[model samples]
Target chain A: MTGASPADTAVQGTVAQPEWQQLDRRSIWVAPVQPLAGLLLAGLVAITFRGWDRFGVIEPAIGAAVAIGVFALSAWHWRTTRYRITPTHVEMTSGMLVRKHRSVARDRLRSVDLTSDVVHRLAGLSVVAIGTGRQGGESDDELKLDSVTTEEAERLRRLLLDRGSRAPAVAVADPGGPAEPAPLARFEASWVKLAPLSIMGLVALAVLAGGAAQLARSVGGDEIWRSGPVRGAWDWVVATPILTVVIGGLVGLLVLNAVLSTVLYVLFYGGYTLVRADDGTLRISYGLLTQRSVSIEERRIRGVRMDEPLMLQLGRGARLRVVAAGLGTKDGEGKEKKDSDMLLPTAPAAVAHRVTADVLGTPTSPVGAPMRRHPVAALRILLLQGVSLALVPAAVLLMLALVGLVPHWIWQVLLLLVVPAVVGAWLEYRNLGHARVGEFLVAQGGPAGRHTVAVRTDGIIAWQFRRTVFQRRPRVLTAIAAVAAGKGTQTIKYALQDDVLPVARDCVPGLLDPFLEPDHP
Target chain B: MRLRPPNNPVHPRATTWWRLQDAGFYLVVLVVAAGALFWVSTAWLVGVVAVIVVVGAVDIVVTPPIRYRKHRWEVTDQAVYVRTGFFVEDWRVAPLSRVQTVDTKRGPLQQWLGLSTVTITTASTAGELKIKGLERGFAAELVEQLTAATEATPGDAT
Candidate 1:
């Protein structure tokens, strides 16, 4: 395994190309464990649902045969998959019958992500996925190495991103170099206190509730209600005062949500760290069970986004996302690498700002700078939109009541929702602001989750201003700054035409000059 | 403070193409509604059909010219500017330096009329600007010009 083995047959005749290497040998055993476990879980579920007595010897025989087949296939996959990083391109060739070859130019490489699931971690292996800056390509756009030694993964991350240093192939420096990169931020146990403030817990709860409802329906909902413990609980609930029951339920849900959120946060970002590596790349590594590391070229980063959800903002916590081009990619499972762009998880707002500044190489984070507010008419427009949106459900309920299908009280109760609608509109109006500070253009908006994005003016590729029919009267418009980075477009929503035009012009300079009419004459 | 309208309007034959498209679409809608009318006996649907007929007639007769006026495009040395839509108007501008690709598309009607739509794309997702209803020869020329301009620019455009 250590020598320039016969597997290098693909590159044997080539002169200057690097030798093609196979996946880690241990992955043949380790990778199979995950799928094998899934098979076992499926078998157990079948036995549990269809009774053990129904599980005949032939079933286990077939299962064992399938397991062996899966292991053999995994080993075969390890044999065929080979990758090499040449000076100009990082190339991989895999598959048996189909024969697939993928090559991404080193210059076009945007991100190198190293991910190790629990099984891979146990075997000390990592999967390296290299993403290019190509737009709108599917999973084929990424070059993936399924399993490699952790040291190899680290070396690849360094060599691929250190294009400026030009240390190609095996001349890579050791990790213990003299100038160790300082971390911009690291996970703190105390930050767990901010986890509950994130909407993750509620989102988890909603998913659980949905699953529970689906399970109940499948198993006959009446059977669950008719059960002894559930029956007693329902009786007690009926006997208790409405206020007490409601309060107790609310308390229970809150406690459950807090516990769930904290556990998820820890599992997802246990040893999180944001570091600017000596290779001129920003490396963010986190996750407890499935360790993941994302390395992005610092030069490719266009901006930073500080996402402060209403709950998180109330708790003085924020999540930061780097606005970079090649940070977006899908893993082998076609799951959009969810946290690939995350610079920091929910943490203290002060820490988020500090990390933002450090990452952007600025003294003060532009996201925290004071911004120009939208005109008062913007608020009026939002209020009208919100009230009209709130009225839709109330109107539906009123129509139902009129038809004698629903009680009249339902519609009346729904009308009270107008209060929250108005409040939300007010919050959205307050968040509508944009400003230009130094070389960055900052825009913030959203009602429940406010995002303040600070994009470098030079990164903006194009400018678009749209006016809806309703907004024409108010003389307000949504100015969208189209960039080739994160989310593609940053919007300054509902700003007065007069306010947005100058900002747009100043941000891109000559780009908008041909279109804009002089305000002077 | 204000934006001057783009310089060039689409080819005159675009009005005929748009009218044909509207006719095809309203024909489908009319057929579907007439089919649904068989299963249900609702008088309001008759009124709905009347409204649809009026709207479709107005769209075929009047909208083509209005859309032709609104859907204007211009290509300068620096950038490409496009304005489209009637009720909900849109203005898109993409600089030549950031332009990624230029493509020409011709639908069946456009092919019949010898007209084409030129789409200019930048690296940004929202940066695709289309100039509809240009002479096929002119569209090809525009694509060639845009390709040359984009190639001359240095940087990765991002």
Candidate 2:
């Protein structure tokens, strides 16, 4: 209902602003629209199939009408939808039947990320994704401009950043100093090739094998190539114990695939650059198939993580990821989604740390100590597990004997439960240790493989001391550490009751005091 | 760290009531289980009536004389402390700095009694601390106090 106001038409700088009418008209068919239309058509066709079974003659005509109706609705919606960016806010108005209008204040804008797929490229239009924090009770804000020129996107970004400085909480650093662009670090796609290839290939092979097995079962038939002599021969070839000779042949093929994909992606993202723009914005641009450019305000980053998988660790390579608020990186569990903030999948730890520091606006020091389960706690855990396992089987056997159902196998059942319980208890005992380093507490415990959960003193949301009836008598308690990662909580449990309070205090000063009174202490 | 008298009248006698109620609940559960067991043992319809009568008599005898001791929170500059437990006595304290949000609610019974429940949420993993059965006027005052403290304090990152 509101037309573009006089303020919206004001162009910054001397750049000539193209008349709104001159912009590409085809931008209406954004990435989602085409797929959505296609889905609607498919649904119509399915409806037609049901109609044909009921009333044969009118089905085809009805299907055609339905298809036309869907297409018309999509076109109508696309034509009516419009977006504009003023210096103060980003405005979007859409919906044909039910008109909706939304706007985000420029100052509240935290980041702008641009992504385009094949469909977007073909249309010669890109999507500008704008993110903003919640103010008042409003939760999340995102604005996606369906069709916009690259130049227009850049102009909008600059204008928003310019206006953002005026807001109360938005602080804009001065860009007066001589621009010292960091030396462009050249990383060959070939250097860290083997790790991704082998991992991906193994996963692919597993998936293919699973699919093939499922298909074979469903068909209830086996082909000669898949299940007969050829399969056996293939298995024998792969099973050869000469590790060097066998893997040596496959390594080239694996590396080639990895390098090929990486090179393709790099080529598509030819002008890939991560630079601090004049206004202190971290701008990252990359594209091969569909170009992507993202700019994030430095202060918005909450934390940084350097992740090293087993193979990457072995190769002395670590991936860097930034934990930026309002980035929408979280999945259902509030864990950061994979491929989100993947600055570099395989970079030197030093470079990773430097980048992380620059992005997060903090010193790149590891914040927390790894917590490990106490040795005595492990023994107790083992005992507890052993008792639980023993009791379950003992109860089952006693019930069976009382019912005269399986009285003969009571001793056998007891033996079955006891042996495994003893082994499991020993495994549990071997995996407990807790330690404090500086202001971080690290707790490690599990069976066989250990998990070390580290928490910074300041990051802990709350600490709880829980004791069961048995534990209270033993003077033992479980301490749980809660950390806020996006929406959900990350909890770390330590089963050492005796020394947990003191260690927690040392790691996180003033943590235990709030829960305990001075007079009582 | 001055401690003021509890805003709500602390009933020390409630502890006895709490113990009795807990015991009574367990006793009722035991009687029901016993009645079921006796009914299973007996084949005659009259035996079932006998089992029911015995359970009812036990429940009636154990129903009264239940009382519960209560404690109320006294807010300090740094923390709010509430001490209330029967056999396993425990005290809870929540710091103002760590407090994320303060919520107040009154249930049907609490409303009838002019009492309210105050919940304090912290960033800590322990979740939230709740102090219930405080006077309505006291709860409002506590909310106002906590909200002001939260706003006055600078955001602590670490």
Candidate 3:
């Protein structure tokens, strides 16, 4: 039975079998939430059946049947789940009716991680997942052992990752171990300052407002959320002086969004701590009730990103994320990248850069490389693009004006928008900088806010240059550097036509030389 | 473009493909224009039909020969360069290392003409680049060469 035909999981029977570890018995306490929901659904269905509405016993019986069935299934699943970590492989077998045996080779293991929620933590249990980093079949390549003790999760990560990779001699979180220098860093309560400044707060507030509005609409009582204050605000604005109205609306939105963001930031990143562990690994642990820990091997980390939205930038704050493969992009993996991959919630830009440098094992942050500006034509292109974008709304306004559908005064507002549009274009052009760092190419883009992404030049697998009819006129083209990790495409947009050849060559030297060489034409 | 050194050209029968496509295009347009004419005996419809027919004929007769002259495909040591698109010429370079897969396809008409299309899929989401109208033998060789080159360049970047 051990001599499996599946070659990837092959093991020599001569070796002592690894001890099989069952998940904490407390795991039974954390039954799947689906059954309760299913019970409710069953009750609803029971009601829909003719005459069942008049029979309370029938409804309760149906609810009890579904509820009991769900609980029984969860209990069985928890009871049968078993896993083991060996020197060369991590194996898992689980399932009530249909058994699933998954084994990943030590050499193939790319990630070892854990997660928990309030209920799981209360029961002293955590979910452990092992990954091969291969992409296919909805997380088939990953093996999950749900609801293990926190201590067991740490030991499994160390024993599996360290022995499997010839990783630096392992240490069990001992501060004084010669194997690991005192953590490169630990959580600082002050880092929470970054949380409130993060744009996630604003985004969260917007999402919350949208969700509330949608909920209101679905419940058929949107008047309270939609029109009550918003319409009142418009009326108030009409009554107030023009300057006061504009200022009041702007200030109110800004303040409310900021406060909401702060609340969300604290809730998610409250006890976040990042520590350098044995063998060039980073241990990231965070959360309040649902504490989780993620171990990132340096070898798997292809790049680090420092994101600074307008608000974060204004506060000199930046959030850090690792641009690595298999962390979140793939299915049945890290469910929320925002919560999982974030290295820093929010920190002073300088401190964030310093941490970036430390994790990257370099004195200078790759993202810190000074960006080289795009040509002046790029600025012109940006302005023209912005103007064209505004033209659509302007055309609609004109059409509406013809029908007396909109105030002609609004035309003046559209006219006024020309200034900001141009300014925005100018800002975008300024941010559209590209630079070649050591072994990495940096591409920065965006307007008002900027995203400067740097990927190892060696990691880039493909290059693309697209020139439209409009771009041809301006002698500019968009060049994309395709990497295997992160969002995949890091674009150098609106590059001067003349600059295209040199940039392409620099990104991957000699690849485009034959095509770029000028011929008789 | 007129003076550019000629690179590898696809099969001569590619012109048949282009002419057939052009005919199909005009056929659709003709039905729509004729249907409009049936509704109103406008004299302008005749003029429009004449213009369309003339343009379609000229294009059918003229474009494929010139386009076959411009379209080129080559495999470099570093990358696969495909130059196509007559008016707005697109010259793409897919590095051998970045090639994820190489495939060849043939339509019914192409099969009758022994023509095949070679496609090179790369990691970049720029959409795969296709070299069409290759002689079947040449297309197969191209796929083999691309696959070998891709394997030869271990861990090549996109």
Alpha-carbon RMSD of each model: 3.5, 9.1, 6.2
Better candidate number, 2 or 3, judged by TM-score: 3
lDDT for each residue of candidate 2 in A228-281, tens digit (9 for 90 to 100) = 566887777777777865686588657765655455545544555677765556
Output the worst ten-in-a-row residue range by lDDT, candidate 1 chain B: B85-94
Q: Which regions of candidate 1 deviate over 4 angstroms?
A: A1-14, A35-66, A137-140, A168-172, A206-243, A397-410, A519-521, B38-42
Which candidate has the top score in TM-score? 1
Candidate 3 at residue A233, lDDT? 72
Which tens-of-lDDT digit does each residue in B3-116 have in candidate 1? 667899989999898999999999999988888788885999888888889999988999999989899988899989998887776888888999988999999999999999
Task: Kindly indicate the candidate among 1 and 3 with the higher DockQ.
Answer: 1
**Candidate 3 chain A lowest-lDDT run of ten:** A1-10
By DockQ, rank the candidates, best first. Answer: 1, 3, 2
- For model 1, what is the alpha-carbon lDDT of residue A454? 96
Q: Estimate each model's TM-score.
A: 0.91, 0.61, 0.78
Docking class of 3: acceptable
Every model's TM-score on chain B? 0.93, 0.58, 0.87
Candidate 1's residue-wise lDDT over A418-449, tens digit each? 99999999999989999998899999998867
Residue A516, model 2: lDDT of 42
Clashing residue pairs for model 1: none
lDDT of 3 by residue, A1-521 (tens): 12221222224455566556677776765756534754464445334432353665765776678767776777788778777765566788888889988787776666677888777777777788776655323442567777777767766676566643332344234433475455555556666665555666568777876865655544345334354566787677688898987888788777776777667666666777778875556777777766777877667676777777776787788778876655544435534334556677677888878888888777798889887777787887788889888777777787899899998877767876778888889878878878777777788887777777777777776766666556666677677777666666678887775665576687777776656645344
